[model samples]
Target: MPYFDSERFASLLEKEGFSASQAKAVINALNDVVDESTVNVTDDLITKEEQQKTIERYKNDFRQLKTDIQRMEKNDVEDVKSANERLKADIDKLKKTLQDELIRSQAGVRLDLNLEKGRIRDETVEQHDRLKNTDEKIANEIQALKTQMQGIKMQILRYMIGTITGAGTLVLGYIHFSH
Candidate 1:
């Protein structure tokens, strides 16, 4: 709200060659216009303190959001790392099992050959074919597991990137609005 200094305004108008009555008339008219046109706008406007409080609230919220996101990211990464380790352990276990199976198979074939010399050749060939098939199946399974692990890794990377991008956007928004 601005004050209308009618006295000063009338004095100025009189000094500028207006008659005293003319100056008074001009001042009265200006006063009327001011009274009609001006409205009390204080209730509708935000005080600086209120604005500052709002900004502070937003900053706190932003910080909490950032912390939560970071925590989630760390947890997600740890989970992926642990999952990778488990998969590797599983693969190692599978390899050991395959080796054990092969050794057992060889021992069995040898025993059969000793016990049945006449049919030893045919049994050995049959055992060899079965081992080959098992080996192929295991290899294919290992390859499939590897592919699945790769896919999981890629998915985690994409999620991390998207989260980082979202966090960056929030940071930029905070910066823009703070001022």
Candidate 2:
């Protein structure tokens, strides 16, 4: 406790030119003086009333230290609670931020889908219109072809009637002349 290593003390004394025996004797003498002083001081300090007083002082100090420790523990608990509350708040804020971002992305996706649906509907309507126009054109073409076919059929029937009339007239004239 007092930085007195015996070997170091002896070596230091020898370094100062004391022979080994002188060094050992000096160290011994110093030890005896120190021990006597310590004994006298300890005897004075160990009286019954003084010892009781010292014990009472130590007890009081121990109680004070216990109170301080309890106070420090209470303060530490409060600090931990406050830190937890702050951490919870931060987590809640982060959750809200993530939720908001998610909602925004969802809305963006919905908007995109709606726009795509509109475009698809417009294309469908345009294709339907084209189909309708094509159908009407095909119907008109069919009607025109039917009219041309009927006209050609009537011309052929007229030519056949004219040829049959000429043949019947020649047969009648021949029979009358022969009779």
Query: What clash pairs does model 1 have?
Result: none
Q: Give the TM-score of candidate 2.
A: 0.42
lDDT of 1 by residue, 1-179 (tens): 66768888889998999999999999888778776665445556788999999999999999998888767666766666676677567667866776676677667656654655544455778766665665566567657756866786676677667656765665665556554
As a TM-score, model 1 comes out at: 0.49
Per-residue lDDT tens digits for candidate 2, residues 20-139, read 899999999999999999888887766799879999999999889777766765675566557556755765685577567657755765675566556657787776566556556656
Which sections of candidate 1 miss by over 4 Å?
1-5, 8-29, 32-41, 110-179
lDDT of each: 0.71, 0.69
The Cα error of candidate 2 at residue 8, in Å, is: 54
Clashes of each: 0, 0
* lDDT score for candidate 2 against the true structure: 0.69
Give TM per candidate: 0.49, 0.42
